[model samples]
Target: MTKIQPSAPLRSPHGSLLRRKAKDNPTLASILGSYEKFSTAALSLVVSDKNSVFALVEAFNAYRNEAVYLFESGKNVPQENLRSTMLEELFSWLFKDLFAILQFDQPTNYWAGKATSSYLTLTFAPKNFQSLFEDPNPKISKKDQDFAIGATVAIKVMASKSDDSAPALTVILPVVAIECKTYLAKNHLDMCSATAQSLKRANPYCMYLIATEFLKMDSEVTPEVTDISEIFILCKAENAERKKRQSEGKPPHPMHADVVWELFSMVMGHLRAVWWDPASSLDRGKVIGRPF
Candidate 1:
């Protein structure tokens, strides 16, 4: 199949916010405009090499500083997932360009995974056979990843092993999943761990990752014991009360280019890796190690 060309996002998470905006809204207008600028800049230059990565990084950080960090508190932030939705759109714009260089044709949704619920799924019914003409009711558990490459497959099943069929069994499998959070607290970390296990159970080769703007844990906590591949702290801020601290005149922990580059490298390595060949690492005398 032919691959779709990379382009600016046709739609964004701000549709509802835009619809709900007061006639004289200014902050939301500025934020939405900044998002468009970043999207345009991202597509204007394709990340063909490391030099291009630098240009993209400059644009990416600029967006975070101007658009993402401007508002404070949910009451004034427009939407709780506003920042996260921006990340999803920006990452998809950038990653699509990068993936174009890799040039693999596959049926994976890049930016839209945020709408697809999750990286795993299940199907169940009493073989009701109520769906020969009607649609099946599949229970979809929402994963709602920030950035993910996955697909949902629905297979309609036969009722009693006969030609008559029942509700379809749908599997929402994510091959590579990235959860985006504005800030990750301890509780969020626990949820991430459980989600990682759920993804792994469905596809052992799945790459589960977390990308958070800040660490909100009471103390520094590592996720080594968890099945998550890695957590990218985009801005390694002193956590616990970053918002209150920032409101008190602390400097914004702007996302570092280095951190973004590290994330890009990790993703590329995972994409190029051979996960299954048992002897693939024997010649190197080492196992497939996760890159930090």
Candidate 2:
């Protein structure tokens, strides 16, 4: 018999809520159901090059449109009560699909055999106590990523240098962190930047990414200077087009297959490539750019 646990910091709090929204939306339900089944099937598929990757992404975009779509009426676009949550769940499903074809069964010290998952609640900041008057037992703070690939590591941070009684802090960290949004604004970018900075400070190896369907930020606002590794805008459609279609009772725009392909390739490259191996570099005689 297996024990059931009420989820908290273990995962993002969007799965159940998104499922509830799907209950009233049959198209979404079908798409999600089919996507979930890919867990066992996708590993059998072959993707040898960029062309194959793009082909797979094209099919995926078709499925994605149904799950994260907005309905058109005229000027008023009707959205699900859990619109943002549904969009969040799309990323959850996406990474799951991408992970399906990867080799996760190969055992490694990283990620503890839980090769891939989405909407994971990870520790951005571990148990921190700086002030002398702070609580005797300080609680840790966490942030949920739409998609993450990493390990839950046990770390010890002595509460006080002079005291022997205090124990270490255990942190649930993500090596690869991704945030998915239906739209991104200036404030959203700022918050994402802050998170990227905080998590990177804690886990320097962590790769932070942002994926959004629509771009709402100002033209001058770019993520290049921020801690974010990359930000992918998956659609060319604008808000006005969405509104016009919604008024006519049409579905939202589909994601660009090329953009999705880039995202998939980026993650795949990161995972498969060796980030650091100084000992092996001496023998192989190959040097790559640092943080390139």
Candidate 3:
């Protein structure tokens, strides 16, 4: 994939919860540990880049069998809640590793569409991308453009019908779209013209831009709109000492907290937060909706 280097120094906000770095570290053991909590009946299919996918498959299978055995002996009977638990654990672990090397500090928000199960789809839209004005050109649908922005990483075990039924594209964990634009363009005429040439989708006429990070709509995007109460900014955390004090007291200033909270708040409303610690072989625990 050709890397589209940022034109400017995409400012990295502070205090954003980020993915942990463990690409080279021992993630196999972590997978194994998570696996040891399911039954043999449980099916798992991992489709990923060839480089690391095989080892991951093997490690998981071994862990699954061990987990089944452990449950059979009545030691740690696979939690009946294996699916949700495992999903949260794996996601947290992976994101943690990714966090360590990520450029931004925004706490990655996880959300699920109306789809059943823990499966989700991530959508990313850069605020400045010219694609904002482009129409969804039915010609370039989601499937054709799956990798156009970023790839969807989903677990394939949730779709199992029977013991023999192969696990197809089961649950879509998240469809993370990168460099997405939410607001209207500064130059409507220029944006409209550019949209004609761009192969991206435009915001639905009814949709409104939810500002985050440093993306503030100027008069160009919304001329008459002056103040928006619901919309909030996603910023970094500074003055930790003052925040600590404020928390202890009532009415903490919003600016003191990390921008991660904004994303977290948005996600918490729609999806559950699953905590996973990639650094340890332990389950960070799953909270079905909301953190703190």
Give per-model TM-scores. 0.76, 0.64, 0.22
lDDT of 1 at 35: 59
Stretches of candidate 2 exceeding 4 Å from the true structure: 1-56, 64-82, 85-141, 158-170, 280-292
* lDDT, candidate 2, 119-169, per-residue tens: 223333333555433324444556666667675655443435456555654
Worst-scoring 10-residue span by lDDT in model 3: 12-21
TM-score of 3: 0.22
Residue 287's C-alpha lDDT in candidate 2?
Answer: 51
Model 1 global lDDT (CA atoms, 0 to 1): 0.64
Candidate 1 lDDT over 1-292, as tens digits, reads: 2334563233344433443552456666766666567667766776556676777778877776765555554664555556557556555654665456667664443333354556365555433576633443444455666677655666554434455545565556666788887788888999999988877876787788898878877656768888899988877875655676667876566776677777777777777766666576787666644333
Q: Per-candidate RMSD vs. true structure?
A: 5.4, 7.5, 22.6
Alpha carbon RMSD to native, model 2: 7.5
The C-alpha lDDT values of all candidates are: 0.64, 0.57, 0.28
For residue 287, give model 3's deviation from the true position in Å: 24
For candidate 3, give the lDDT: 0.28
